[model samples]
Target: MLERLIESLEAAPMVQRGDYHYFIHPITDGVPLLDPALLRDVACAMVTVMDLHGVDKIVTAEAMGIHIGTALSLMTDIPLNILRKRSYSLPGEIAVHQSTGYSTGQLYLNGIEKGDRVVVIDDVISTGGTLKAVLAALENAGAEIVDVCVVIQRGEPELGRAYTPLVTIDVDADGVRVIDTCR
Candidate 1:
């Protein structure tokens, strides 16, 4: 099942967590380019999670998640929106500021009208900080968040329906493990 795939991901060190090996790797390259096969696996996982979560549109951050989000969006036939960290020359775009646990950044949401349903996408969820900002931005734009999907979900679950991670990774002590299980 999903657990096997997650375990495999963990075993590969594809995603890392905290200062530990919640995942197999931390994506230190900031890009999954090192392993095309791994990237493909992550992309496939994203698509599957999105489909299961009933996601309509994919919303993600500007730099890191752009490639992964685009790939997943294309795979799922869903529209993609890039949440810019700062507003550029684009006019009429709704820009809002929020804090992720890691840092504070601005989110620019474009082309999405009020009341639209969107699913947030990212390459990884370390502390859920960036994802929190994305969620706030979506809410500010009056869009309902259908779910949050990532190639890997780090940290312990918040539970209680406050938020849901499409995937949970498990890694071994030696920075090697598989995606133990996915939720």
Candidate 2:
């Protein structure tokens, strides 16, 4: 199953940005050119391997992570909480500083409270900075992070926590390559 997904991604349209290469796929970039079925297959594969039992909520960042998180929440019958880029002047809302490989900004947290057991899901893990900040915010909120999952991991940046990524991508002067897989 993972092999098919890998093949599909390998054949995806890639856009080079300076020294980085980005795969414009439905799962990651949500390129409308690709069929939605591809994203479903990737999400289903991730759900199959991840142990969501005992988790109280599914948490994810805004944008790309929303689709995967929604799917997981529906399948597991758990509530989904998304960290938004915009701030909401609401009670119990918390904000955290996030720095990723590509960009840095503030992420707001809501819909999750103390004592909640959550699994953080995302589309990609590159520098691990975003996940690190998110973990800190979740911990500060008194939420126990059960696990972390990423659909694609671009590089190793020491997240200080264990994470399961469907595929690990390595890019350099040689271009993108699937160096590792979680299947």
Using lDDT, give the best candidate's number. 2
Q: Give the alpha-carbon lDDT of every model.
A: 0.62, 0.82
- RMSD of each predicted structure: 4.3, 1.7
- The clash count for each model shown is 17, 0
Best by TM-score: 2
- Report the lDDT tens digits of candidate 2 across residue range 1-183: 677667766766767887777667777777755455666766787777677779999999988899888887777788999999999968988898999778899999988889999999898888898889989999999999988889888877688878899899876554467888986
Q: After superposition, how far is residue 148 of candidate 1 from its true place, in Å?
A: 1.5
Model 1, 66-163: lDDT tens digits are: 87776677677788888886667565577766564446777777766688788877766657766776677677778888877666656663422344
lDDT of 1: 0.62
Candidate 2 residues lying further than 4 Å off, grouped into runs, are 173-175
Positional deviation of 130 in candidate 1, in angstroms?
A: 1.4
TM-score of model 2 relative to the true fold? 0.92
Candidate 1 TM-score, C-alpha based = 0.70
Candidate 1, residue 50: CA error in Å?
Answer: 2.5
Query: Candidate 1 at 153: error in angstroms?
Result: 1.8
